[model samples]
Target: MSAAFDLEAIRRDFPALDQQVHGRDLVYLDNAATTQKPRAVIDAVRNFYERDCSNVHRGVHALSQRATVAYESSRTTIRKHIGAHDSREIVFTRSTTEAINLVAASFLRPRLQPGDEILISEMEHHSNIVPWQLLRESTGAVLRIIPISDEGNIDLDAYQGLLGPKTRLVGIVHVSNALGTVNPIKEMIAMAHEKDIPVLVDGAQAISHLDVDVVDLDCDFYAFSAHKVYGPSGIGALYGKRKHLLEMPPFQGGGDMILSVRFEETIFNEPPHRFEAGTPNIEGALGMATALEYIDGVGLEAIRKHEERLMKEASLRLPEVPGLRLIGQARQRAGAISFVLNGIHPHDVGTILDQEGVAVRAGHHCAQPVMQRYGLSATVRASFGLYNREEDIDALIRGLESVREVFA
Candidate 1:
């Protein structure tokens, strides 16, 4: 009903939104986990398989050439999506986990010395935390955490203190998946640069909701997943500075990653090819490009405004429910909200919500450190996307009311 955006028209593009569950209209609020694909993205994947299915950068035939163009074109699209300087800076990976691991292994591990430090925030996902732990085990480097306040914002002063002469790299999430806290990445990156430390931003939860510019942020490394942005699974991208990608070693070695091979020595191809080993996810890349195009059509500024309105409405209404406690009250946030009901397990709340045809996520959200910080085992989460509307929030509220009635 808002003049700036037509919610119904936007909803029509996503076929999955027009469905029923348990004889009631489906209300999907699990977008922080993975987004439902738009029809354009789905058709792009199907078209690739139906007409242009072939291995990229290897075949000489028409299908192969077509597939190669589509695949590589997606890389270019993604490069522009994040405002990287060149397409070669974008390396395709299976997920954000792989991208971060690539940077941790090839970029940071070799450079680290005993007693060197890698700084991360308290709100990082396990993907951001565990890789550094593995690197620390191998190289004897120390991992230092930047403490977060009770409201879930990273303590800026604490973060500055964590940066010292021994600090080599900083890995932080641009947005908290569980708490929806949007970190001050630009400021944080500048702060780290003051100590000449490189920073890698985990943008998995941010790319879909915000207008991300790697050039503007001047981050050393940035990563995000396609599925989190209404694209297909099994494909994502890591955007590194040209200087870093050229210097870093390959994460995986296989066909297409090398210029030539022999018994003596294999000449490695330049990145992003060096990082993309084996047959790349050609279909996935094309589908992801279509998804980005879909987002572009909607306009990120419009999406941000719409989601902000929804967040404000939910913040006002959800608290009115008896015994429901909203967690992570950060002044700046997006995409999701985590909460708990007194005496009710999160799984129980999720199950009850499902009976009323409201889909949500229930668990630690792969951020157990965050749960530990809050002194809880798990919390129920409701995340948003472009297709979401006020009706979805209303449905979630009514479902919670039903849960309260049952518990009473």
Candidate 2:
């Protein structure tokens, strides 16, 4: 196997990285927030607007047919990407947040009764938390949190005891955005299956780094953001089993999601279309196909191997800064480091790092409860992706060392 990837070839595809930031060559460690798009994805969206700018599904004209074919073809592209059983199981949504809300609203709401529980992790993004809170409020179902240890890894022994007859659903992140913990989702899913409870794995952080197959995982549902996975914004997809998606109520009601309608009565369409409504984001979906294509070309194993190398280097070097402490030291972590420095607020660390031409995410990272659990308001987070290299990690260390020196 080749020990190298053509980094320059890969870097040239992202136009945003071609320029300077603060008079310095950009380091772009902010990938966990959103990835920079490839030229292919940009062109895919542009091509749709320039040539096939029309509404989808209903029009008999050529432009509409053009739009419909491109838009629907993207669904097939994504269905194959995640290895879902059928394209009909894929439903387009606004983003991961909207996708999770779709399941919480359409499926969980009706099935949940009083005393039924929604099991989620303490490390979940706020997107995973709020929807279940709404479900609890609406259905009187209890919300049970699977706690994490000091290193930010979930306690599986504790989680197993929580999984019992009353557990209606298990929603957990495939990777923790803040902690960089790659969750044991396959085992988690298998355990949930034994209990006869359905599971939904939030693949928002995992899709960029690992292979994802909904059928292989045997998950009841999976949700992830297109933007996070090198696709365009305002679009994402949900993979659900056909039977479950067919039974769930439509998350939103509008045109294109229905088979037939009247002023007096109406009927919704089959699984995928039943969940997608209104004027869909046709261009965004097309761009998602481009992003998926680019990722496939790079190969997920290559991406993960590169990221793991970066993480290994960072793990060895990060603790060397005087007064710096690392959080989330899970042995099975992906490419992230959430750290704190003595006598410096995480926000201050972020601002100072920004001034030094280094961009890193800081704060609770939408995992405030985890922050509170660790007695921290926040910590500075630096997450790695396929594009990152040893030089970036070196720059991060040098930047943090400057902060340590100045603060002292």
Candidate 3:
């Protein structure tokens, strides 16, 4: 956070950043997909395997007890990080995708019925859209998409018109993975509450960039993957309000999720544990906690400010390149910028950028409907993160010189 925060020191923690992609330093801009883990997170993961390794919640053995403490301690750490009122409200799932699926399966599928509408914005990722679609297919609930404005933000008045007595759940992304538009979720959540419709904030692209207070947002459920926030893959969290989690049925049936298992009847455990089935990824959870600590230590506000500077600087400089069209000019955004090249296909641009050792994401970014909303098939996206520097965008610009030459 200070002016003394060393970029080189932070970059050194990520071993992957030291590699050469194409005779150049790998300038990775795909932070939205998964952030490179810091040395702290990596060490935390390694420590688990090296010293403590055992199944959690069921063992009195020394190894099991140590592993269980590390794993559950991670949950406690995260609960405080996200401002959840209770630790039991936090459910560990494989990733954000699985977390959303848990809500769709255990909660929405049971309560939703024919003619009920599940409202979402056009900008939701495929994970958010598909799970609700699945619930629709099973329960016959209509899926209504709130439209986006020309500026790439959701039309809130349109959303209000869509919400009514029949509207059951509002599943919207807090930040667009494709557009990088930060939705006014606090307002949206309040509106949904006024109408008694529960809202679930898909925070995959948000938690890495902003502080999320689940109680303050007042959303029924919020889901995000740890890997997106500089943690390891195969780990994520679902934060559900205690009342909602208590009412919802168990997501998966297995060893830890049950209180007592019988051939005829299996009683499920309480919230969080009820949804977390099987022997959990113990190391991943501990590493995720360490990852949050890494952020907390550096301070999330500072990271946000640094990325904001990069975004503004990149936005100002990039438009100078001819035939480069910036997409998603929302008033509030974070960590990502989507753009289209005049004559080059998105894939072609990515291929050429890779030649310069500059990596960027290309495609709809799992937001097919959002692409359709903006009348685009796909676009090349360069996203920023904590470790990114102004020189990174300069490298990105230098890489695009080839795209201009080739397309010209």
Q: Estimate each model's TM-score.
A: 0.98, 0.98, 0.98
- Specify the highest-lDDT model's number: 1
lDDT of 2 at 375: 89
Clashing residue pairs, candidate 3?
none
Q: Write the per-residue lDDT of candidate 2 for residues 11-106, one digit (tens) a residue.
A: 898998777777777788888889999999999999888999999998999999999999999999999999986999999999999999999999
Model 3's lDDT to the true fold? Answer: 0.92
Model 3 C-alpha lDDT per residue in residues 1-408, reported as the tens digit of each score = 445567788898888888998799899999998899998999999999999988899889999999998999999999999999899999999999999999899888888879999999989999999998888888889999999998888898998899899999999999999989999999999989999999999999999999889988888999999999999999999999999899988887888989998899999998889999899989999989999988888888888988999999989988888889998999899989999988789999999999999999999899998888778999999998899999999999998988898878
Sort by lDDT, best first: what order? 1, 3, 2
- lDDT scores of the candidates, listed in order: 0.94, 0.89, 0.92
Q: How far is candidate 1 from the true structure (C-alpha RMSD, Å)?
A: 1.5
lDDT over C-alpha atoms for residue 2 of model 3: 42
Off by over 4 Å in 3: 1-4
Residue 204 in model 1: shift from native, Å? 0.4
